[model samples]
Target: MVESAPVAEPAAPVESAPERVSAPASEAAASIAPAPTPAPDLDPGTRRGVPPVAAPQPSSVPPVVESTPAVAGTAAAASVIPGTAALPVTGGDALVLRGVTKRFGSTHAVDGIDLTVPAGTFYGLVGPNGAGKTTTLSMIAGLLEPDRGTIHIGGVDAAAKPLAAKRLMGVLPDRLRTFDRLTGRQLLYYYGVLRKLPPAVVESRTADLARAFDLEDALGRSVSDYSAGMLKKVMLAGALIHSPRLLVLDEPFEAVDPVSSSIILDILSAYVAHGGTVILSSHGMDLVERVCTRVAVIVAGQVLAEGTVAEVRGELTLEQRFVELAGGLSDVEGLEWLHTFSD
Candidate 1:
């Protein structure tokens, strides 16, 4: 009885601290977050947030880039032009030559060559007298056949499709043999008809050329009566009248007067400015060096060097390079006595 009195009301065992309350599911989940999703495969060492590597896929589709075929031998002769590489033709490149070659009996006029000419480029072809510059140009202009090679003009294959390729080009050969009896205007008209140009267009172009080349005064005159410079100008005008994508000239300034030469140069420059391509062959290194964006130096039916003016010239001046590469001078020093008077 005495012991029970002391324990009096030992508080009904303070209800074991209200059973400890468990944390809510949301709070517990946040405390131990799921391991971060592993980063996707990508270029190694790249920073986060950068684009991930594209996954590989099995497919039969070919890649977008295709390899270009190699050109060699006569088949590669078509690419023998200078400056043309930088000036692509109107259809893709004004011209292309791949493994082309031409032979005249024992002489291989042109060896394997490759060339590309972009539209609106002023190109110069320079070489010694027999370096095949003319032969290469003739092949490009469709005047000469390559023994082996592919020639394309504005994407039209010259050998396989001569007519189409010729339509895009105007050629002025070193020797311009025309119908001497025909008047300058009549000659142009005849060529216009051959080219199948619209009558109105041909007429208008002819008139424009006449005025531009100062040929209006000579329009009614027979070609046979025209002076050398006049004939050259007329031929140039004829080539330009068709508005061809390419103008090919071989020794255009030869036998021309200074004033006429300047005019021709101005016209050619203007044509290029208006998006036309020009391929000129000239021994006048000064003229070529002054106007050409690029040049090709050929020697004995092969390309000795091909590149921009600065590239071809390198450390030597254009004149110096020409003299060195063209063999030796003609020994003009031996003729110095021509100026001496007998005592």
Candidate 2:
């Protein structure tokens, strides 16, 4: 069973401090079962959708559809229906951050970061280590509060109407965990129900996702026993089960096998094709260039540049551009005395 945790209360004011929303304890401590040993001559049925070890690498996955900006806050209109206490956005970006800031003791982890994400866009957030990418994503996902600034989803103020704002989002945080006591299928079922999906619908989607992600054979095993790659796959499946309007993922490809990574790429592409928005942060510059239509480079807690990939890259590759944007490395130093060794 997952443990419960307190949710962040509304903030004092945008001018005072940022607000953070904590995950329920159950999610924070969840675990997955270990992967079974691979069979050299396994067939499709026995493999349960797992691609053969010799399957094409992740690079072979096709590029997702090219994304274009959508009227940001227009979708919020649907939130105003009887049961929802919608955000107040009218005609703006789907996601907006104005002067968002966060601090820890004397350090400013994120400083006055402002961003706008259009609906149905595939946006990437890239930064150097300790550049505040994770911190910024955490705040945006409502896991941690910022010290100052305002956040809006579909024009609804996130701090003021978190429940409604969150309902429209599915998040896969960098440090996410799952319920260790439950099986893979059980974990997805819990989240679907928590998101208020109908039981039959939840069951059907769970089966489809398990098959798609190649977790069908392991559905009945305990999550705590899963391999690192398998765990990442299951968490990803949970993130998509709700068919949320927006997706927030951090280092989603980390630890995943190449074949499984290809599967995820296809899934995300299809989601965006149907109008879902995705925001992701990764160190893989090449992957970002291949998958994202828009990109943002941040350094020292602030955005260095934000625009279409072509605009940001200009004549330089995204990595070269990122190096220039985030302050490229100085000439190699030290180890002057090092010499080649020979047996």
Candidate with best lDDT: 2
RMSD of each: 36.4, 15.9
Give one digit per residue, the lDDT tens place, for model 2 in 1-343.
0111221111100000000101221211111111111112223243211111222223221111111111112123123222222122123366899999999899998999999998767899999989998888777767677789999866667788564456556677665454555677776765555544445655665666676677889988877789988877777776665555667788889888888887777767655654567789989999999999799998999999999999999999999999998888887678565665657
Q: For each candidate, how many residue pairs have backbone atoms clashing (under 3 Å)?
A: 28, 22
* Candidate 1 accuracy as TM-score: 0.69
Residue-level lDDT for 238 in candidate 1 = 62
| Candidate 1: tens digits of C-alpha lDDT, residues 265-339 | 766675565456788889999999999988888888777777888998989888788777778577677787889
Model 1 score (lDDT): 0.59
Model 1: residues with Cα > 4 Å off, grouped in runs? 1-92, 330-343
- What clash count does candidate 2 reach? 22
